[model samples]
Target: MISQSLTLTWRSLVPLKNSPGQLLAMLIQPVFMIVIFVYLFGGAAGGDRAEAVQYMLPGVLVQVALMATIGTGMNLATDIGNGVFDRFRTMPIARMAPLAGRILADLCTMTVTLAMAVLVGYLVGFRVTTSPLEALAGLGLVLLFTMALSWASAWIGVIAKSVTAMQGISTAVLLPLTFGSSAFIPATDLPGWLTAWMSVNPVSHLAAALRGFTVGGLDAADVWITLGWTAALLAVFVPLALRAYNRRVR
Candidate 1:
């Protein structure tokens, strides 16, 4: 199973080789967006450039993490549409091989996005005040959350009618969850109703947890909340995605 999954992972990565433009864009987009947020709107958002980058970087990372998964469903849908799964079924690979491989491949891309975001954040005056270990833990939290959500995305990919439809549906769900969270602004700054919702938002907790890691000491409550959210996403989505994969293959 592991070898088969690895092989499929390599196969999944081949697209990156073929489409250099997409890979270049993937590396560039986060840097551009973070710079705009920090340099252009920094004063308006957080009163000063450095302060705004500090306040906004975590939220931006959370948003990027979520956005990174948006393409997972679309790619999975494309593979299914292209009859790739049919070919896979003929091989003696584990049932989950293709799905797991695709998820792992996406992780590679997410790693680049996260690393580049941090580098760019530093260039624009974002600093991590917490210990190095805590900063690492914060990045782990982002990866965990993204991996969990990507399973849900894989499920959507298998179930959606088309690749375009998959992208549309995933974007519709992610955009609101990201923008509505405490990522960009303080929850207190939002309206009461939205604030209440943001308090429960997984993105909000994840952002807060990350902010604590990068700009302040740990927040035990936020860490636990983010873990709970990650667990919930994985528990609910993993089985659903596997089931969807099974159905699609059949």
Candidate 2:
């Protein structure tokens, strides 16, 4: 049954073989955002900024992973809309298989997007102060963060009444979280009110942890905070998403 479920996931990823354009579109937004931020924010404003790339790169990468969740949710919604979920429900597979499989299927695309984004940053003169091992760990952290969010998105798709509604609702939830946090700058750099919020924001912590890795500082406190938040998100969202999946199936 587990094998069958995993096969379903592999089958799902196979369709992308013919949909290069879709993958490209999925990746372009993050790359574009990186470009705009680096040029607009990294200019004279950041001239005195210590490790400008270190600061900006982490936030940019987080945005890439966070944005990828939208695509995952929307894809799942499409599957549900096209009657694929109904068909999968009828198949002999573990109940969680469909959701797990779908999440696994997206790993490749998400990894590619991350790699491309990092590569673009590197090309434009962003060097990691961290060693290769720490850099690898940083990559793992982002992957973990992305997966947790992806699971939440899957649940969103199952509960959303329609694919379009899923898109709208998820976008609504995401935009503020992305913009309101310290993805683009230090919390202290923002207004007093925004700074207060950012100090406690999980996204800010992740960005801080990432920045630490880039500088080889490996801020243990920030990393612990980020992991704690990711774990909490998984603990809550996993069951919720699973419940929704079961409901959709039944």
Candidate 3:
């Protein structure tokens, strides 16, 4: 199963060689977000430009990580819509290989996006005040969360009627989660009702955990909360995605 998944992962990635534009768009997305948020909205959001960069970069990383998962669903939906999954169904491979392969490919994409975000963040004056290990830990946490979310995305992709519907559903669900949380502004700065929601918001915890890891203050609580959320997402979504994949292929 592992070997089959790896091979299919390469298959998913091979198209990038012929689609330079797609790869270019992926590379450009993080850079664009960092510039737009750190330069244009930094002053208004964080008061000091340097402070804004530091505060916003971690949140931006979380945001970008979550947003990157949307593509997983869209790509899967595209494959299904185009009868690619039908071909997989007829192949003498593990039933889960196709889904696992797509997800592994997405992880590769998410890693690149995170690396790009971190590089762009450094170029824009966002410094990681913590040790190198902690910075890497922060990135790892984001990836872990992203992987869990990709399962949910894969389920959505499997069940969705079309690629357009998958895109729409993903955007609708994720936009509120990303923007409504502490990904942009501080949660305490929000209104009472919104603050209440942000208090329990998983994205808020994930962002806070990343900030804690990269910045000076490392809170065990934030890390724990983020892990709890990650585990919960995986528990709910993995079975759902696998079942959906089975049904779709059948």
Per-prediction TM-score to the true structure, in the order listed: 0.96, 0.93, 0.97
Error of 3 at 188 (Å): 1.7
Model 2 Cα displacement at 243 (Å)? 1.2
Give the per-residue lDDT of model 2 (tens digit) for 1-250: 6787679778888888799898778668667877787766865226643456657877888888887887778888888888888997777778888888888778767888888888888876678887888877887888888788888898898888888898898889888777778877767666899888888878887877777777666679888888888898899988998898888868
Clashing pairs in 2: none
lDDT on C-alpha atoms for all candidate structures = 0.89, 0.80, 0.90
- Best model number under lDDT: 3
Model with the higher lDDT, candidate 1 or 2:
1
Off by over 4 Å in 3: none
Better of 1 and 2 by TM-score: 1
**Top candidate by TM-score:** 3
| RMSD (Å) per prediction | 1.2, 1.9, 1.0
Clashes of each: 0, 0, 0
Residue-level lDDT of model 1, residues 1-250, one tens digit each, is 9998899888999879889899998889789889776777677557677789999998888888899897889889999999999999998889988998999899889989999999989888889998999899999989998998999999999999999999999999998899888888888776899999998888988999999998995678998988888888889998999998898889
Quote the positional error of residue 133 for candidate 3 in Å.
0.6
- Candidate 3 weakest ten by summed lDDT: 38-47
Error of 2 at 36 (Å): 0.8
Q: Which pairs of residues clash in candidate 3, taking residues 3 or more apart in a chain or in different chains? A: none
Which digits, one per residue and each the tens of the lDDT, describe model 3 over residues 171-245? Answer: 999888988988778877878999999888899889988998898787899899889989999999989999999
Higher-TM-score candidate among 1 and 3? 3
RMSD of 3: 1.0
